[model samples]
Target: MFSRTFARSLTHTRPSASLSRACLFYTTEAAPATPQLLVRIKADVKDAMRSRDKERLAVVKGILSDLTYLEKSPQAPAQVTDSVIQILVQKSIKRRQESVQSFQSAGRADQAAQELKEIEMLKVYLPQAMTEQEIEDEVRRVVKEQGATGPKDLGKVMKELGSLDPAKAPKKTVSELVKKVLGSL
Candidate 1:
């Protein structure tokens, strides 16, 4: 039933039909797993395993485990959308950041470095992060659109900005930019 274009789009360079299908289905729905992202992650994981790169392998395994857990959970409902995966990846990144900080504080530089590497790998799948200037511009636009003025209107502005899609504009960056813009108001 799948068209040739769809099938072509699905195939990862690694030759895994199941994974290709998963990638295509998610990307077509505009939710999360783009073919490029799936191919990259899968290839990296395979390379890590082949090269006996324990740290990288562990990171990939952790991500896959999380995906599996989400898949089996009743809370996921009938469809495990790309939006869900994106949220999971965000959470994973946040967790790694926290771990890196903790490891540094505990004088575990090796562990911290590993966590940082994993964070970098996970970030590859994420949409391009907005630069500070871009974020500031977006915040200003949203603030103006909402007619927000002064610090008292911070809540209103934040609510509006937070409603934006993280895939298009990350919420954390947008929040910081909004604060900066509102602070100067």
Candidate 2:
């Protein structure tokens, strides 16, 4: 569900498939050449602007501004890709979550609600996060594969986990699994 113009722009702007693919996994429904997540974000931003959904529009605008700034930054290596965008979105979500907690702690319910709304909006672009069970299963598989037996093997396990495909399994979930497995060890 990507527009031709957007797809063309992406092709022209993005570095290479290998780099981007390393950052994100393409779903079966995604276009071969373009990341579906970016396309969806752009489309939703447009819709929000057109519908005059002020909060959504503002959030999307902020996201876009961040994306644009990142894309244009010379300091960012040439390998920076859509996967980098995914990382940025995750960071934004984390920031929003922290803000929500801080606001609630300060008795600023309105501010907390606003941050929560932004978090919800930002999550729309992230891949479906993996469940704890799924992450645990994968962690077990990795542990088995690496022959990791104790907490001392945590470094090896974490290295493997970091390289594992987050598109196939969410990173945060996998990280938690690593911690749990290590604790048990």
Q: Pick the candidate with the highest lDDT.
A: 2
Candidate 1 Cα deviation (angstroms), residue 67: 2.0
List, residue by residue over 108-179, the lDDT tens digit for candidate 2.
Answer: 999998899889888877766667787788789999899998888878998988866555466767766787
- For every model shown, what is its TM-score relative to the native structure? 0.61, 0.68
Which residue pairs in model 1 clash with each other? 31-82, 32-82
**Residue runs of model 1 more than 4 Å from their true location after superposition:** 1-40, 50-52, 73-83, 151-163
Q: In TM-score terms, which candidate is top?
A: 2
On residues 1-185, what C-alpha lDDT tens digit does candidate 1 reach at each position?
Answer: 99998898877447679987877756434564344544566787899999999877887777778878987887864665555566678899999999999999999999999889889878766776667787788789988998888778888988877756676577777777777788888
CA lDDT of 125 in candidate 2?
74
Backbone clashes (count) for model 1: 2
